[model samples]
Target: MATPDAPPTPATHPSADDVPIDKSTPDAEPPPELPENARARRYVILSFWLVVVLLGLPLWWKTTSIYRAPLPLRDMQSWADGRACRAEFPLLVEVEAPELSDPEHLIKSAQHALDDANDFSAHHLRLRLASPKLTDSTGNNAEENVAATLKLLPGPARSSHSYQLSNVSREIELFYSPSYNPSSSASSASLSLFVANTLQEIFAEEQQMISHLLSTSTPAPSSASGDSTSGSSKVNHAEIARKMSRILRYSPTYHLTFSLFTGSGTPTSWEIEDAIDEYLQPLLGALSGISNFTIDSQIQFYASPSDNVVPEWQPDGEPAEGEPQRGKWVLKKQDLSSFINSAEWPLASITSYPTINFIIYVPADELTPLSISGSATNAFLLPQWGGVKILNLPVEKIDGERKTHLTREDLKSSLDTFAGQLMSLLGAPAHPSSLPIRLDSLTRQRSAELLTSASSTLGSLYRLTLALPSISIPTSVSTAVSSTLESLQNACQELKQGRVGGEGGALAEGRNAAAQAERAFFEKSMVGQVYFPEEHKVAVYLPLMGPVGVPLVMSAVKELANFIKGWKASRVAKA
Candidate 1:
């Protein structure tokens, strides 16, 4: 707009290089050259290195390092190697021969026979004489010290010998002819021989069970084949495998789920509360000493079996004309694994211990008169799980509506079978016909099992940590490991002392220790993010650290070169 008064403005701005410098103003003399501060340059280089060493390195380590908990690695390894503990069972047997002139002689002779008969070094028998005064005691005074009591009674003539075991007590009465008394001159007593044979027979099952457990728990020594007890200790591998497959793992507590599943809506109610109280409570009460059990019952309507109807079958021989064309609806042994769809039946209550499912399915009207294997038993056992029973109407009602309710009396037999299945699934042995005695044996077996399991878990944890050096371990893992070791030591000591009473707290300690070891070994934090690759880390930090490191490295190299040049010049001048 003011182009007439002033020189015409340039159409476009001129670049800095294109602009002309005015010569009218003489360039001011350059300021006096400042002295080069070699010290300052050196300080800059040193400061960069100091920051890297003092700050960067420590920060990287703090972020990338794995947290490892302190564990008794040596002790755990020793335990895994089977050097720390050797399991032993010293059973005490009391002989009661009040009729004998001297019971002490009989006990000594029997003990000698037992010692000769016993081949396994870990398990042995000790015989002792019972006091005559204990005979009149109202309560079992000697139950604490004796696994079993041998009582000798005088029998009538013509009866050589017979034995009777008291169902109510731990006493076994041996009826012998009055003339069979031990003679002072005879080196081997007949009475002692009888007692030894009976004892050997009575304990045969327990000995076999113990031998199987020991064989599976520890590594077999090379010298075992040369030892005299090797045959006695050796058990069939297939049998041991079968036993391990059938029984559930040891736990401090067990949850028992009793469910009534019906194909129709009418049979929705059950007298389950009363039935459990009347039929199953007694057994649970008896097992309370060894383990805690929580019972829950429910009824489900419109439920069906895995297969609704029977399939056609071809027998080995030719089919008969009169035989039913439809094959029996048999749940084959192989199909038992898929009998219960676990995903469909989520647990109602969350529990630490494993859930044992007991199912009673009532079929639809069309599939009534249900029978398992077309036999008297309508129940079958699921290995490591509970039992299943198919309930059929007591009165065959072809047209009538399905039974709407199940009374306590109607559920008694099925519940009884469920109780037996419960025992089997828990790994309890069926022997001695005494519930208390069987449970006691189960306690000892469970303790040994838990101890072995815990040791093996600890070994696995050690190996895992060694293999993956970058995995994180929390402080809780350390505390759990310590507790597990301490509890295992205490359990081992208790076993060594032959203190296997469930109420004495030894068995529970072993179970708890095993659980803790499992928890620590499988800690969530340690296993997660263990497989992150190094390439991914480079991809994440390359953009940020690349530019930052370049200038620092170049400056350091330049400084080093100058310093080296100065050093050589000084050396030459000195020469």
Candidate 2:
């Protein structure tokens, strides 16, 4: 027991050096990646890139690309330059001489004289014997195609050769002497010469207008003598230009607004409907063949003139002896221009067509008889807009109250002035004393104007397309341009055939062309695309492309680096 105790006290722990070692094999290095596995990984990355290139990229491009319709730029330019079509007007005049046994000779002689006297061949008149049915019992032209009816009547023995134009119809009465004979060569020559001279005088203004239009627009056709400027010296180009500037652009419809504006609360109502019906209906009926019109009326209270309309005091015909120095307010000529308070006036209409406003402004009692200096009239035209009249109405006292109202009689003069202004604004010629003839001239003028305008618009559109290559052109615009070109060609053909006015004529077709050209030029899609620049496209695409492109580029670079490393190692081993 003592020996065991001594051994236990001497016992000691084993040191790390004396510990026993059971050595197990260290973990083997991961097995070298198989060649097949490495190849499979590279192929996987390549498949992803192929999907992105073949499918994703093409899809994005297809979604973002703009659709542009092709256009015929060259054809458009040719039309604009007046190379595609040549416009000409050949008028036909009918001569009615029922009393003459041989009207054919008279017609032949007159035509010869007309041809010799005509300097502008494009607007030459051809004389033909009028058919019996062309004139009505009242001696007016029943055929719309006939410009005028020449009624030949035998004059009294004492009467001389004379002609009178009817104010109510398109008839020219030629009073030939009873001694005149169509079979006699000398008499025929004299009568033919007279007729030719009269016709020339009647159409002189129209010829000048048409010549001016041709000279100002496309190259004019040469005269019979091969001179284009033969009669250029006779044209008043400045006056024609001024008158054209005042006329409104052609439209299918027009809205006329008659407004009565008073400086005070009086004159709350007016018989404008009756006045228009009586004074304006006749003129409107005459112009119905050209354009349609819609009428409206209104009354406004407390409408004052512009601040520039300051009036000066003038004595009223030397005040009666001690009549408290009677005086009247007079507006100067300069003030007439600023008499309209457009800012406060409700001049705008809701119709889509153009609006022609006629205002009747009644002055206050304190400023009655507001007359323009150096002029007896108080009405003035506003040129392409409308007319204005200063109505100095006398206030009537009834039952201790003021009665201010406009009757049809009080507005007669103003309405007459408005009618005249309307004609001037509509480009009616002021000669020949024949309404139908004047309207015909206006029709030709408007047709020429609209044709030129449409051509100019087409040219501008073509230039715009060239200037802004990035702007998108829609299919609608292409269709509109084609329609416009077709209409222009039709109009030119109609003009060449001498169909100047009326529905389905040159004027109507020209208007259609102009409208279509405007629509094409102002297409909303094209205009919207104009502001979207290449920079904007870049800004829009960069964010989407950045994330997708970065990974693809990095993967490609890594794969390339690995491939180069393997190639170098294999080369060195082979060496």
Candidate 3:
């Protein structure tokens, strides 16, 4: 649209207006250069910018925010409702009769006797008929080693008596009577009742244990297992709660550190190897399903405890050298949290594996009557950590009674205590007094607790994503959650259906559920994003945008005004 003869400046163009020459004309909105409605226009533009900065900016910020994954808040809360699973322990009772050709009848008779005598539904006995033709090799040597074994000899001089197994220490007894023969069809009262009653008496301790566990979680027999608890006995839920609180969350491999702390170097070594072989190894072997135990023992001497100079042993930081050393580094309740003496102690496990430490602190004779100042409580539990026991040993032993340094022999009693305590911390149920029975209770309890913990954790993960609005959600987390939920359902079903692990064949389903739940809760992708503050975001975005944006916006406004003016003039002409 160019013409060859046209001049570039329109102002220079001349028309037939030679007579009309105006010399005093002003342009560009007068000298001050103010446009029409300049103040109102400026205010309008300013108001628009203000709206964009305030309303629009914040809207964009919020709209493009991160996507947080959904969580199952209600499900999580329900899991924590403390009604998830009530641990029920039923003891496995084995009754054997070597003389009887048909042991099945005796087993049935004994079971009947036990059922009649039992009042607690949760802690009843399941009798196993000893195979009349037992393959001697199949008998658990571990069991045989810890209990008394009886030899059944057929005779008219009939009397049943239990005898210690010279080799295996199995709890087996011999019964005799020439005229007594029970038929396979018989399911009635006879000498079997006597035997059953005797068996019950032997396992009285086990019954009390089941009662204890039941009382902790749910409805109880009021009195069962002859535990010295009365029929009107109320559940010590708090005590049970304490037990649950103290127990270590379930782990497949439980590291048991047996540490021997002494103030002096006198008892540096112990016959622990032999004692473990004889007394402890078999019990641990029996608990294969409940847990895999790794034991490491250390004998520490001259191990000085931190002290406070004050006679009351109140804490006051480091004691000044000559000022009565006020409290002599006395430990307080708060101090237990960091009191592991990690620097000096051989704190790490030998295998470099994940472990739960069980500490035994034997203070020096110089620091007698040691306890946490003010807390007044001697033994205390550290959450998710390990347990501690402080033993006060006599300075010397006069006769067979202990009076001196802790010999390998004296350690037997202490190790026994520690071992027992370890089982408890491991959440082993107290019941049926039978070692087998106890082991079985521990297995079930662990499965139940693990199941709950994992499910609860999964539920937590479900809720967390919902609470934090600006978090990135990945498919891995979803997959993990799904897998864990599936596994938990399987485990809970197994528990309800009574298909969970039994003695050698521990509940595989429940274990899987627990493992899956833990995996889900600890999923790596869930915690990948770190939170950035809002101010930091503003700082990052404002630098480049503020300067560059101003000119671009002004240019847009001018172009828009010119287009509007031309369009309005065209419309007016048409009107």
Candidate 4:
């Protein structure tokens, strides 16, 4: 009984105090940390956050922020809106009448008549007397300041009054009857009126073109009386559109490609260099003031016409006795547009300048004497492209075999046609019969065109910047824009001063402005930021920042909550 009682003495569960504690083992929970240590831990975390906020954030921003240069947005917008510059063409016409004792009277009368007749104020024609010394020697104008020279001479007795414009120069000669006296007021008034009318006729097309350009570029205010000749009344919109469609856009330079496409390999080479020198050099020289030209030539053998140019077979008119029957090929006018086989031909431009292709296609012997239906000449013009001449070479017997080659003489007519087409494609006016006057008109037109083009580009760029706020604009773009604005200002000044053409003139300045504007608008760096937007950057950084930011944010929140609780507790105790 005593042994059983001793066995039952041990309890199943022992009390916490009854358990034996090991000195090597630590307690289940450590003692509460000292306030100094807790404060130190908070101080360390706060310091880390302060480093990230003050130093790390700024460093990251400095390294990653886009560099955007300040642009002259207002000035650009002003230029685009046509408020900055108003183009004016002040033409100077020189009077050279060596026979007249007092030229000033005639000039005054003519100027009065001109002022009264002219409806377009933007094109002011100022008349000035030529220097006696300069005109007395050669009767030629030595100065390039005048747009044209008006030459007055007394004709033979009983001869009728007539006027003729020099084809090679800017001189317009007026031959009056010997009976007509310059001293008589009636005769002087009549002569002055005639001169004014002639001048107006010479510049009518130019005024129309300028008016059209102004109206199209910026809507001009309509006159209350609607008597303004500068309105659409004078402009033939359909004709202008057709002409403009045929003309290539204004450029400082153009590349000319003269290609000879042959169905057979007989005509492998041609005297193109000589032909160009003789027929095209003069035109090119005259246009040098407006633009430069680069010319090249190539010959493609075994080249055939496109499918659109299906030729219809027609028997040759009454074949000679004992001669084999011959046939001719005819091309339809409707199919001329697709005659150029762009897919097979090498018509691609190699240079940066706009290319004008002049094609001379020669068919095989069987298809000789090819002609277009209902057309006199075998030539056609491609609007804004170039011209095509279907040259059919006569088959000649050489060493009892057929042979064909293009000589300078053979290419003369084609070259002449090409020259005329070139003038048309260059926006040259068909009036006055004076090459120099037409060239001057071209200069003014090109200047206006380039100025408007540059302004439009600047406007587009400004709009794009406003639309895309995140797009990066580099310093180069700002520099280009500044240069463009400066050049535009200079061009406007030149135009105002009547220096619209020639070296370092309004045209040149406008070209520079347009180039700079294009550079600014097409900056490659601008496209990069457009593709990589703010949302994309955030997405890229989310994985890395999530882990790091969560810990920092939670710690800050916990610390703030603890501070608020401690503050409340202290306030309660004090109350």
TM-score for all predictions?
0.80, 0.84, 0.57, 0.86
| Residue-wise C-alpha lDDT for candidate 2, range 146-224, written one tens digit per residue | 5667767778897768899977666888888777877688888988898888888887888887777767864322222
Q: How close is candidate 3 to the true structure, as a TM-score?
A: 0.57
Model 4, 180-280: lDDT tens per residue? 77779998888888888888888888877776776576422221122442443558878787788898998889999999999888787899999999989
Predicted candidate 3 versus true structure: per-residue lDDT over 120-204, tens digit per residue: 5544557665444542542433231112223445644644433222223234454545546665233235556766676566555
Better of 1 and 3 by lDDT: 1
**CA lDDT, candidate 3, residue 286:** 79
Q: Candidate 4, TM-score vs. the true structure?
A: 0.86
Q: Kindly report which residue stretches of model 2 are placed more than 4 angstroms away from their true locations once superposed.
A: 1-41, 99-106, 137-144, 154-161, 176-194, 217-233, 320-328, 374-376, 395-403, 561-575
**Between prediction 2 and prediction 4, which has the larger lDDT?**
4
After superposition, the stretches of candidate 3 with alpha carbons farther than 4 Å from their true spots are 1-24, 28-234, 271-275, 306-407, 496-499, 502-508, 528-554
After superposition on all CA atoms, how large is the RMSD of candidate 3?
A: 13.3
User: Against the true structure, candidate 3 has what lDDT?
Assistant: 0.56
lDDT of 1 by residue, 289-365 (tens): 77788888887777755553442233346557987444333444555556564555544567767888889887676
Q: Say which candidate scores most in lDDT.
A: 4
Better of 1 and 2 by lDDT: 2
- Cα lDDT, all candidates: 0.72, 0.81, 0.56, 0.83
